[model samples]
Target chain A: MSQPIDKQRRAFLATASGAAAATAVAPGVFLHAVAEAAPRDSAVSDSVRYGMLIDTSKCAEGCTDCVSACDRENGLDMLLKPEGASDQHWDMQRPRWIRQVKLKNNLTGRVTALPMMCQHCEHPPCVDVCPTGASFRRADGIVMVDRHTCIGCRYCMMACPYNARSFIHESVRLKPTATPRGKGCVESCNFCVHRLDNGGTTTACQDACQHGAIVFGDLRDPNSAVSKALAQYPSEQIRADLKLNTGVRYTDI
Target chain B: MSKIHYREWGIESPRYWGLLAVLAAIVALGGFATLYMEHEGHWVTGMTNQVVWGTPHVFAIFLIVAASGALNVASIGSVFGQKMYKPLARLSGLMAITLLVGGLIVLVLDLGQPARLIVAMTTYNFKSIFAWNIYLYVGFLAIVAVYLFTMMERKANRYSHGVGVLAFVWRLILTTGTGSIFGFIVARQGYDAAIMAPMFIIMSFAYGMALYLLVLMFTFNTDERPLGDMVVRRLKNLLGVFVAAIFYFTLVYHLTNLYGTENHAYEAFILRDGGVYTWVFWLGWVLLGMVVPMGILFHPALGAQRGAITIAALLVVLGGLSAIYVIVIGGQAFPMSMFPGYTVIESGYYDGVDGMARAYSPSLPEFLLGLGGIALALLATFVAVRLLQFLPTSLADEVVDPHLAK
Candidate 1:
């Protein structure tokens, strides 16, 4: 019985090899396709480093499309004030994944508009200061919080240089299917990991930008839009002096 | 040489019960405040996304650092072999444990998810300073407990020195870990300096000694125990030295920051421009906390007076709180330099537009919670002294100082 099973396996292998040869497809391309088709729950490979490059020169001064789109996508827009909280108080307390910032050069007086979020540093201080390892960086370079492990110490908020993280100040309502948020956890820009896992390449902000100022792609892929754009135009990380080597880059800051 | 005797405070006065009642009430109020804050979320507090840590951290860090410093008297007795300090060692150990528990309670209750404390304990993040602190704190508690046991039990006395030395080393590392929590953050301009660790060590020395002195005087006076001028003077001088050391460290820290051109704006904000921060630094910390306390402790007329010494100790505690406030809240109030050359004209996330500092005002609940930690520490000390033979009936010069008896 063992010999017959071995003989059958050999025959099957021969037929599979013959079919592969007939197709004449490159082995590397075939393997790449197979890897891409694998389940999302499989560990994230180091081969892909997701990054974003923002062309601030093209960003409109008053536009909040990216900010509003991120809020809608993350269900941040659906947040409600506590029973008696003032609008101003609630505004300051609410979590924001992205914000439109207008900057002006002190000396040159040149104005620039851009949307700022998590820079997703290669070495995140938030991850380092978190007592419970709740603040973590994925293998693909997206920085996120594990809600289950986050004890709401807000040490990550204290450690974050970008001021990108927000603590849920009130009980959340109508949380989106993609983002699972609650009271007493730190949340930040995840680079839309939910969208990425769902086979979407672009973030909500990138998709909503009418000026095409936001470019999101795999940094490891040299031909990817973000990589090509970064190579063509000089881009600098926010707080470059800290040497955090951020996944997000900006031009004409 | 006469054997020193230790006795439990056997006072049954209504005043004692009144004191306990007041402290318990404060703790209960603090518990209520904590539950309200936790249920309603941090929104009820003055803490914001910009100033994430507020008044509670100031009080908690002060108490935590003071807890490490409170053990200095015990270390002096056991490790340094100061015969005069031996009788006071038991109370020192008790205070150390009590203060630590009090501070930790405030810190845990302030968490976003206080109920998830078990997760914080079980999970390990070796790379994080916060995680390392958990170990340091627990280890300190255990070591100090053993040290206390060695001091109290006759058979364990021989091993006291070894355990005392271990406790000393652990404490230094513990305080260093605490300081590193702020020091390691390279992102914030105010806290990246390596001096923070040593500065916190020195600060713990000053704050802890001052608090210890006050507790020692209050307990002895209330129990009608004879506290000696010799012992009081020694502790007072020690506190003066620690306070002076704190001043020196503060000077060195600022001078180092001033040397760097990058720190100029930050230094200016703390020293001159920062509204409440500037006042708190100069007046609350520098003048009232250090200068007045130092002057009172060293004055020819005032130094010898118990009343003056008590006032000085109180001042040191106030100053310590102010200093922590400046470091924790003020450090965060200043905006991060996200764009070095460019100024933020407008931002949606209260990112300190136009180089403005983030606003923070402590709410009633925040203050109540902080006060609760203090009350808890006092209550623990009060109860322990009443139950255990941690205090001597007398610390009079003839009793504590053998040379004087001779």
Candidate 2:
């Protein structure tokens, strides 16, 4: 099985240059075109596809307006209410669309406010490994958890490359009204599926950016700010060694 | 109605109904708590983030592993003639099935969405160890059930010996799979070996034998035959072997971890550094779970003496229970960091037994519910016994005596 896969790689590479010139067929004759076109670029176009770029240098620390925008738009506060006798619905942790990650760089003696969430990898391990097909990646690259069918096994918890998933160990009703209620099963970053589906320009993080430090765009368009930023500036994704082909990008400044 | 009397397996009337009532009340308490939690959520239980999986998952996995060993005796002895274990075979099989069910109940109550458990089988992450474990656990129980059914089917009831043989072989593989669930987790310091599966198998045999002896003792309290002196000796011998195997498993598990480089492993070292779980690991698990029990059985006075063996059996049961607590809690208490110089993040009491950041002491309700699962197992077994006569009514000496089989 490993041998055949290697041979296919060899054959695919042999035809790469020939296929590049024949592009008018579009969505076309070669698989490598599909690979390159599956952009990590920052370009947000008129197309339906969406992406995020995190700027670590000017984290605009202490400002939680993005979190507030998310909480308000997503009805997240409702999920944290204490379990009441009358309430039948359990509060989901409403996987964080954006989170503040404070990373301490030992050598530099600097603490950076890196608001981290899901990287939303191109070769998402979560989706590939889900036996029951509960984890999936859409054609446009948003990863989703079908909460309706989740079995609460928390296997994805162990498999996650990022400690991104959280198990809802308790009922939402029993939490403080602001408890960010979640129960049973598991969840993590969903990239604001509700907002993206409605053709919103960017997520709460992008809208909340006072410094315009955050960017959202389509890599396919090649003209978006994210694309231009990546082209000119040098930055990196966390754990680049992992090779997830993640859609999320970051710039130091 | 006069109580029916028989003498084949040392049969005589005994009043076990009082034991039955106390057990029933505990079962009801457990069931009541579980029902409350289900209606509410796991919030009704004492578990929290740091201690996300507490007593329920701990005991559930322990019992499941123990049951695999218990079932092994029947599979090995009854079908394959591992004569060293033949005499204890029937009781081991019965105890194995009951314990597996008991373990399953503990896990179900621990779920945030207990009702959603069926979805695990329905929608599995084929790549996740957690998903595979659920499947292995279920599959093991199913094989055990068939093995038991066939054992009881007799000449008049239909079935072949081949299925029983398959069950026996499958059980060895099943135990190995269970061990691997913990062993393969390179990230978790506590479980990293091929040995845990076999270790778990040995543990089950020990637990099952302990349970069988206790049950048999109760069954034969008034009988003239005394369940046979020879049968007692045979079981004690097996108990000794299991203890040695368990001891070997413990040593190898630790030695491998000492050499391997993982954060969970470095954390495991903390277990011996006079931490909350250190004493529990050393005295409770090493001395008590393995050494003392083994010591009692190795002595001739304890080994040959009927009363001594019973006391020995009780100690073994307690030791097994302590082993489960130490292994599970020790594994969890490990700080998330995997490196030495980086220092593990210590939170609340939940991470350790003291210092109180994320401390968790299973509440009265949680403890009661935990004990209730055992009570439920006993009551279930008892009611079944009254209705089913699961113990044979007519072994040559009525309670299995190799001496009398001569």
Please identify model 1 stretches exceeding 4 Å from their true place: A1-38
TM-score of every model versus the real structure = 0.94, 0.76
Candidate 2 lDDT over A1-253, as tens digits, reads 3544687778788788567765655556466565556543334333544567777786766666666666565555445545452222222223344555444443554555656556777777666545466676766667767766665555444444454555664455533332233467566566666565544557766787787777877666678877777777787765565577777877872
Worst 10 residues of 2 chain B by lDDT: B347-356
Alpha carbon lDDT at B343, candidate 1: 86
The positional error of residue B197 in candidate 1, measured at the CA in angstroms, is 0.6
TM-score of chain A, every prediction, order shown: 0.84, 0.67
TM-score of 1: 0.94
State, as a TM-score between 0 and 1, how close model 2 is to the true structure. 0.76
Which tens-of-lDDT digit does each residue in A1-253 have in candidate 1?
3444688889999999999886776777888787778667488887899999999999999999999999899999888878888777678788998998999999999999889999998999899889999999999999999999999999999889889999999987689878999899999999999989878899999999999999999999999999999999998889888888899999988
Best by DockQ: 1
